[model samples]
Target: MSQSNALIIPGLKVALVPCPALGDTTLLLRLAWRLQAAGACVTVASVSLASVRSYLPGLNIVGGAPDVVALAASNDLVICAIDWQVTVPLSNVAYLAGKKLPRGFNPEQPPVLLAGRVIAGAHNVICRDPKAGKTMVQWIDLYAEEVLGLDTSLPVTGLQDLPAVAEDADRRVAIFPTTPHASKNFSSSGFRRLARCLTARGWLVEFVGIPAEQQKLKAEYPGCTVRTFTDLKGLVDFLSNCAVVISNDSGGGHLGSLLGLRTFTITRRRGDFTWRPGFNELNRVINPILSFKWMGRTVWRPFIPLRRIVRALADVKVQ
Candidate 1:
């Protein structure tokens, strides 16, 4: 097909099936922007309502493979953000019948199998090393300009349109203190201590989480302010106006960094660190100083001290 002809296909549609987690969806959102810039209409397809809302505003939620196939039939390009193993059968069947199925995020080299049929491969923007993370972000920015044919003049304020706390009060601090898993959760006692320390430092701490988590944090933290956020807008608003954010290795930490907030993240050694957010120089990561294997197991042998986290927080600069 001619380049202009491909660009003018009236029914050309691109579908992005984001991973189950909110962070993955957020990454996919960046890709969606690039795809849209490439002249393909993009729609995010997912199963989680909250996940869909967090990353994709007008998502097409699907219940099963049949629904996905139906959606794929009408589209010219489909990017599977979910694990390739789960979607390989559907992708193969679709491709055999002349549909485009582009694979996403393999650690190895890009496959030559669907050459020309695939719009882009997933390995282009993923990184595990901290230094490479910055490179990956830069590559994505370039991809948006070069491959996607987008202008380089667009503003790159990450998540700036989302709702946030109303004011930048000097005394307010946003404490994003929850994780999706128990292993990543800091000790409640440690959190209470941290809250009291921030309060003593004249910072009014607000705990942000889902509704149920807000209730739990309130019961645990007593005097701390608790806010239950329903959408990405609300979360962004809260993070944007906060003085600083102390969170686990969850979506909150990523959101905090994206909003230019000073962020401190507490993560277990075993948690995935490949996609950690880069907040210029204001973000800190605290993990147990133990062997890699020790951190990977669910239970730990207490290789690191809580004092290290306290010291790290103490060293943070408000600016």
Candidate 2:
């Protein structure tokens, strides 16, 4: 289609369906920001309310197939995150019937012949992150730029923007203690040790996590301040106020990096280094030793001492 034709479509809408998790939802929100910049009205559709809240502000939200179809009809383009496999058939039908541009992977890239009138495998249009081979963030940025014709460099809105820092706080430290999988979680024992160390140094530590997880941690660390919020807004609010963030390989680390907070990420292995966040000064990734066999080959690992983590945090230059 011609660029003008694509740009002028009335009610241009893009749907972002995210995995029912805070991290994935955050990635989708970034994509929404890009889409909005590109001139497309973006709606983040998900069955999970938590996921929707985690999305960046200013994007539309839809909960079911019926609404998704109705929304797609009026908009010229519909970009669905691959996580919405349950409602793919309905979405495909809507795109075919409405002649809307459909973007995103479907059933592992189905054959064009069997995929029917819908745009099969348009999901690949959004490039995956080279590190982890996941398209979550890259795709969001791509959809916004390529499909929406929006400028990617415009200051990212929503959670990426931080509140002004408090002048009186002795020190601001962001604590991220959650990970999607056990393997990536920084040891709670190690975290408690670090927390105690920071507290002893008179730094104000802010523990950030999903609401439920934060509540649990608050109960555990009665004296510490823990902000358990599911959405990016609350998370950013806390991160913005912090001078440094110590995180595992989770959404918190990503947010810290994006918001210009100095982020120190603890990883279990180098392979987990994918998506460590760009801009070297704002983000530092520290990998601990772990042995694992890859493709039937044994690999030895080297450990990263706790002293190293502390030193890295000390060296961070807060902007």
User: Could you estimate the TM-score for every candidate?
Assistant: 0.66, 0.69
Q: Please, what are the lDDT tens digits per residue for candidate 1 over residues 170-243? A: 45677666777776777777777877876665567788878777667889889777898776556665666776
The per-model lDDT (C-alpha) reads 0.55, 0.57
State the lDDT of candidate 2 residue by residue for 93-142, as single tens digits: 21110112245534344422212334344444344444554333554565
The best candidate in terms of TM-score: 2
Q: Name the 10 consecutive residues with the lowest summed lDDT in model 2.
A: 92-101
lDDT of 2: 0.57
User: Model 1 off-target regions past 4 Å?
Assistant: 1-12, 46-66, 83-165, 169-171, 270-272, 279-281, 289-319
